[model samples]
Target: MSTYLTILGYNSAIPTVNASPTAQFLDMEERAFLIDCGEGTQVQLRKAKVRFSKINHIFISHLHGDHCFGLPGLIASFRLLGRDTALNVYGPKGIKEMMETIFRLTETHKGFEVIYHELKSKSSEKIYEDSRIEVFTIPLDHRIYCNGYLFREKPKERHLNMKEISKYPEIQTCDYHHIKSGRDFELSDGYVLKNSILTTDPTDPISYAFCSDTRYWEEVIPLIENVDVLYHESTFLHDLKEMADHTGHTTALEAARIARKANVGKLILGHFSNRYSDLSVFTDEAREVFPNTFLPKALEAVKIG
Candidate 1:
C-alpha cells in the first residue's frame, strides 16, 4: 500500500548548486523502479535515504547524457556494494552495447546479473506485466531514440465480508468463489442472501506516466489521458520557447498544456534548465495553464494520492 515518487534530480543539461540532472525513483510495495539516471543519481538516492537494494528495474527515457549518464557509475556502485539481485535495464536500442562497452573496458564484473530489454522507439507495447502492475512503453517525440513509461496498477479481487457470510451456515464453503463474484448465496431452507447487500466495490487502480526530454507531442494524449499523475519534462520557460523547441525540449507552459489536454489528475514539471537561478517562473507559468501543477525539488518525495 506504500506507493510514492521521489525526485532524485530535476535539472536539465547541467548541474546546479541546488539540483542535479533528471532522475526519479518510483516506490511501490516492496520494490522500486529508477527512472532516468542522471549525473550523481546514486548520491541523490543515498541523500534521500532510499533503499537502493530494493531497486530491481531501471527505465531510461532516452539516451541523452543528462538523462542516463550516471548509469555506469550506479552499476559500478551496485557491484562494489555486493549486490546479488539481478537488475533489469529497459531502454531504446544501443543501450545494451553502451553498457557492455563500459563494463568491458573497466573490467567490471557484476556480482549479480544484468538483463537488457531493448525497447522499440517507434511503437507502444506492453513491456512488462506483473501481478501488481503493468508497464507499457509510450513513444515520445525526441531528437534521439526515446520512449516514455506508463505504469498502471492491476485490478484486485473483491474482499469477502466474513461476518455476513458466517450467517449462512447451510451455504457450502466450496462456493466461496461464486459468492465473491456477486452471485447470491442459497441456503437449504430456500433462503437467499443478496450479494449487493454484503459486498462493496474495490478500490480503483491508479496510473502514472513519465515523459522526459521531448517536445510537445499530441500523440501521447490518448495513451496518458486521465492518468493519476504525469511527470513531464519542462526544460525551459516561455522566455526561451524557441530555443527549447529547437533543442527538442519543452517549456513549462507547454508541459502544462499537455497535462491539461490529457486531463491528468496532477502534473509534475521537472528537468529545468540551469540558466535560471530561480524556479518560481516554472511553477507560475505551468500553473497558468494547469492549476494542479507542481515543481519538484531535488530528493523530495511526491505522493500521487
Candidate 2:
C-alpha cells in the first residue's frame, strides 16, 4: 500500500497570511494519522479534501500553542459530526491533564471516547501499532518534553509470480496462498519445489519520520536513518543562528545537514518563520547540503513510495 503525506500547515510559531502553523497528515492505506494540530488544521484538512473521519489518531509533538492549539476545536467538530469511533491522542507529559482541564472548563464532552497516551521518557517509545503500521517516538531536543514520530510499514508477505502460478494451473487456490507465503508446494506427483524458485524479489518496507520544532541533535539521527521521507522543521535561515539556538529551533541549513548525514531519501522542509517573505532562501540553503530537498506547499500532498 502506498502512503501519502499532506502538508496541512507549514508556518512556524507565528502564523502568516499565506501560511499556518505546524501540522501534517499521513494517509496510509485507508487510515489517516495527524502529526500536529496547529490552528485551522481541520479547515486545512477539509481544503485538502482529506476525510476527517479517516483520522482516528492524533499525535502532538509538544505542548506548544502553535503545535496543539487546534486540537480541542478538531475534537469538538468530531462530536458535531456525530462520530462514534474511538480516538487516540499521543503527546508529551501533562497532555491529559491539560486536556482534562480545558474540556472541564469548557464543558465540552466529545461524542466519542478520547484516549490519551502521555509520553514522559526521552527515547524510542512504541506509541501505537496495528496490523499495517507501527508508530515509534524519537526523542527530540526541544524546550519542553517533545518527541517526533516514525511511521514504519509492516513487512508484507511474499507475492507469487503470476507467470509461475499460471504455469501451474492445476494448483489449488489454497496452495497459492502457501506459495505466496514462501512455502514449498508439494505437487500430487510428490515433486517437491521450492517457493523461492517461483517468487520474485521481496519488496522492502517504506518508512517516514516526522520531526519538527527541535534543535539540531545528531543523537536521534540513527533512529531516523534511511527513512523514505524525513520531514524536519526548518524554521529560520542561517542568519538567525543565535536565535535558533536560543529557541531550540533549527535553521534550513541545519535541517539539510541532518538529512544529509542521516542519508535519507527525501528531505521535506517546512515550519517556515514569518520573517522570510520568500521561501526560495530556505530551499536554496537546504539544497546546498541535501540535493533531494523539497519545500512542501501548504495543503500539498506528497506521496512516499
Candidate 3:
C-alpha cells in the first residue's frame, strides 16, 4: 500500500506571490483526504494533479479564512463537475452554519449530499475511520476553536509465504485467507502447521500527525508520541517568539521542541509567515533543536513507511 503526503500550500494567514495558505492532500492506501481547504486550495489541488472526485472527505482545522476559505468554492466546483458521490466534511462547531450561509447567499445548490461532522470536544477523539485508517482530532491551543488531525494506519494483515504454501498441494487458494489471518492449518493426517511457519510478520503501522495554528502545547505529546511523520506549524522564527506566543502560534524552535519531546520519526515544518522572504531560516532554526526537521515545498510529496 502506498502512503504519502502532498503539501499543496503552507503559508499562513494570506496568499502571496511566493506562498498560499494552509492546504494539503494525504494519500493513504490510495484514499484521498483534504486536510485544510485554504484559499485557492482547488487551484493547488489542480496543480498537484489530484483527481477532484477522489477527495470525498475534507478536514478543516479551524474556521479561519486561510484554513477553510476554499471549501465552498471547491464544493461548488464538485457540483459543476457532475459529481454524485457524497462528501464528508469534518470541522469545528459553527462550520455548518458558515457553509450554509455561504450556500444560501450564493444561491448555490449541491447536486450531491454534503455531510458535515462538527467537532466540539476538548479532548482527543476519533472523528473518522475506515477499514485501513483512522483519523482523530487533536485539540489545539489556538485563539479560536482550532483542531489538528492525527491519521493512523490500521494494523495490516500478515504476509503469506508463497513457498511454504506451495509445499503443500492440499493448501488451496481459498485456504490462503486463513493462513494470512494467522490461523494454523491442519492436514488430513491431523498434522498441524503453525501460522508462523506459513506467514511472515506484517509491516508496522504508520501514523501522521498534523498540528497547525497552535501555541507550544505539550499536552498533545502523548497522543502523537512516536508518530512516523509530524507536520507542525512554525508560523514564525525564534526571533519573533514573543509575537508567536501572543498570537497563539508556534515558532520554529517551539515546533522542533515538540517534535523532540514527542520523539517522532520525522518533523515537517510549515505554515510560514510571509514576512520573511527567505524560508530557509525557518529550517535553520528548527534544525537547531530537531535535526530531522524538514521544510517542504509546495506540491512536494513525502513518503511515509
Candidate 4:
C-alpha cells in the first residue's frame, strides 16, 4: 500500500490570507490521521476534498494556539455530521482538560465518545499500532510539551512462488498460504524445500515522519532515520536562526541538516514564517544542505511512497 500526505495548512504563528497554521492529513496503511488542528483546519480539510469520516484519530503536537486552536471546532463539526464512532485524540498532558473545558463551556453535546490519550513523556515511545501500521512519538525540543509522530508500515508477508511450487505435485493449493507465510515445504520422503527458494521478498515498508514546532534537535535522528518522507518545520531562514531557536523553532537550513543526517528519502519543509514574501527562499536555503528538500504545497495530496 502507498501513503498519501496532504498539507492542510503550513503557516506559523497565525493564519495568513494565503495560508493557515500547522495542520496535515496523513493517509497511511489504510489509516487516516489528522496531525495538528490549527486555525481554519476544518476549512482546509474541506478545501482538500478529504472525507471527514476517514479521520478517527487526531494528534496535536502542542497546546500552542496556532497548533491546536481549531480542534474544538473540528470536533463539534464531527458531532453535527451525526458521527457515531468514537474519536481518539493524542496530545500533551493538558490536552484532555483543555478540550473538555472548551466543550463544557460551550455546552457542546456529543453523540459519540472522544477518547483522550494524553502524553507527558520526555523519551520517545510507541503510541498507536495496528496490524498494518505502527506509530511512535519523536520527543521534540519545543517551548512546551510537544511530540512529533512517526508512521511506519508493517512488514508484509512474502509472495507465493507458483513456478517453484509447481515443481512438486504433492504441494497443494492449501499449502500456498503456508509457503507465503515463510514456512518450508516438506515431501513425504523427508525432502524439504526452503521458503527462501520458493518465494520472493515483499516490498519494503514505507514510513513518514511529522516533526512540527521544534527547535534544532539532533536527538531525533535515530528515531526517524531513513524514513520515506519527512515533514519538518522551517519557521525561519538561517539569518533568523537565533530568533528561531529562541522561540523554539527551526531554520530552513537546520531542517535540511536534520534530514541529511537522518538519511531520509525526501524532506518537506513547512510551518513557514509569514515575514518572507518569497517562499522559495526556504527551498533555496535547504537545498544547499539536502538536495531532495522541497517546499510544502498546501491542500495538495502528495504520495509519500
Candidate 5:
C-alpha cells in the first residue's frame, strides 16, 4: 500500500489562536502513527476524518507544551471511547512521569493499557520494527532532548512472471509462493531455473523523515538522505537566522539547504512563527535553494513518494 501523511497542526507556541501547534498523522504500510500531539490535536484528528482507534503508536518530539500537551487529553478520550487495546507511546525520558502524574492527580482509570517507551539516547537508534516496516530515531538538537522519526517500508517480494513460468510444465500453482520469494526451481529432469528468470523486481519502498524544532544541524543530513519526503521545522525567515540559532530553530532558507544537500524527493516547511502573516514568504525563500519546497497545509492528506 502507498504511504500517506496528514498534517494536523503546524504552528509555534504562545499564540495558538491563529493556528494549531505541531501535530501530524502518518499512515505507512497500513499502519497508523501519531507524531507530536499538540493542544486540540484530537479535534484536528476528527476534522481530518481519522479513526482514533487506528492510532496504536505515538511519537513525541520533546517535552515542550506545544509538542505534547494534547497527549494526556487524547489518552483520556481513548479511555472514554471504551478502547480495550494497548497503546504504545514513544517520547523523552520524563514523559512517563509527566503523563502518570496527570493521570494520578485526576484519578483517571481505563480498561485499556498504555505502554510508554521513554528514550534518552543521544545517537540514532532503531525504535520499532515489524515484517513490513521499521522505525528509527533521528537525534535532534533542541533546547531540551528531542528526536525525529524515520519511517520506512521494508523491501517487498519479487513478482512472478507468469509467461516465463508457463514454459516449465513441471511448475505447479503451489510452487508460486517459493518462486515469488526469490527461490530457484528444479525440474524432475534435474534442470534448474533461475529465480530471476521467473520473477521481476518489486516496487521500490517509500521512506519519510520528520525533523521538527531543531537547529541548523548538518549531522541529520546523512540519516535522512534520499528520503522520499521530509518535514523540517522552519520557524523563522533567513534574515532573522540569528534569532533562530539562539532559539535552536531553523530558518526557511536553512531548511531548504538541508533538503537540497540530503537530495530528498520533497521538502515540507512547517512550525511557522505566528509573526509571519503571509506564509508564501517562507516558500519564496526556501524555493530559491530547493525548488521542490512546499508549505504545510493543515489536515491535508499528502502522499509521500
Candidate 6:
C-alpha cells in the first residue's frame, strides 16, 4: 500500500499568483480524500491531474471563506459532470444549511446524493473509518468551530512467503489466508508448521495529520503524536506572533514547536500569508526548532512511508 499527500493550495486568506487558499488531496491505500475546498480548488485539482470522480469525501476544517468557498462550485461541477455516486461532506455545524441555501437559491439540483456530517465535538473523536483507513477529528482553537483531521492506516495482514509455501505442496491456496492470519498449518504427516515460518510481518501502519486555520493549540499534540507526516498551518513568522495570535493563526515557529513536542516524523508548513514573498524565512525560522520541517510546493505530492 502506498500513501501520498498533494498540496493543492497553501495561501492564507488571499490567493496570489504563487499560492491559493487551503486545499489538499490525501491519497492513502488507493483511496482519495479532499481536505479543505478553498477557492479555485477544482482548478488546482485539474492542474494536479487528480481524478475528481475518485474523491467521494470532502472535509472542511472550518466555515471560513478561505477554507470552504470552493465547495458550492465543486458540487455544481460534479453535477454538470453527471456524477451519480453519493458524495459525503464533513464539516462543522451549519455547513449543510449554508450549502443547501446556495443550491436552493441557485435552483441547482445535484445528480448525486450529498450527505453532510456535522461536527461539533470539542474533543478528539473518530468520524470516519473503512477497511484500510480511519479518520479522527482533532479539535482546534480557532475563531470559528474548526477541526483538524488525522488519517491513520489500518494494520495490514502479514505477507505470505511464496518461496517457503512452495516447499510445502500440501499447503493449498485456501490455506494461504489462514497462514497469513497467523494460523499454524498442519501437514498430512501430522507435523505442525508455524505461521512465522510461512509469512513475514507486515509494514507498520502510517498516519498523517492535517492541521489548519488554528492558533497554537497544545491539545492537538497528543492526538497527532508520532504521526508519519504533520501538515500544520504556519500563516506568519515568529516576528508577527502577536498578530498571528490575535487572528487565531499559527506562526512558523509555533507550528514547528508543536511538531517537535508531538514527536512527529516530518513536519510540513503551509498556509502562508501573502505579505511574505520569500518563503525561505518561514523555513529558516521553523528549522531552528524542528530540523525535519518542509515547505511544500503547490501541486507537489509528498510520499508518506
Assess each prediction's global lDDT (C-alpha) against the native.
0.86, 0.88, 0.93, 0.93, 0.94, 0.94
lDDT (tens digit, per residue) of candidate 3 on 129-162: 8899999999999999999999999988899999
TM-score of 1: 0.93
Count of backbone clashes, every candidate in sequence = 0, 0, 0, 0, 0, 0
| Model 6 lDDT, residue 17, Cα | 81
- What is the lDDT ranking, best to worst? 5, 6, 4, 3, 2, 1
Tens digits of per-residue lDDT, candidate 6, 105-192, equal 9999997899999999898899999998999999999998999999999888899999999999999998877887789899999999
Q: How accurate is candidate 5 locally (lDDT)?
A: 0.94
Pick out the ten consecutive residues of candidate 5 with the lowest summed lDDT: 12-21
TM-score to native of every candidate shown: 0.93, 0.96, 0.97, 0.98, 0.97, 0.96
Off by over 4 Å in 5: 15-18
What value of lDDT does candidate 4 attain over all alpha carbons? 0.93
lDDT of 1 at 280: 87
The regions of model 1 sitting more than 4 angstroms off are: 170-194
Q: What TM-score does model 6 achieve against the real structure?
A: 0.96
* Model 3: worst 10 consecutive residues (lDDT sum): 12-21
Q: Please, what are the lDDT tens digits per residue for candidate 1 over residues 161-230?
A: 7777777767666877786677887677777778875566657777889998788888888989999999
Show model 6 residue runs off by greater than 4 Å.
none
Pull out the clashing pairs in model 5. Answer: none
- List where candidate 3 sits over 4 angstroms from the true fold: none
Model 4 error, position 19 (Å) = 0.8
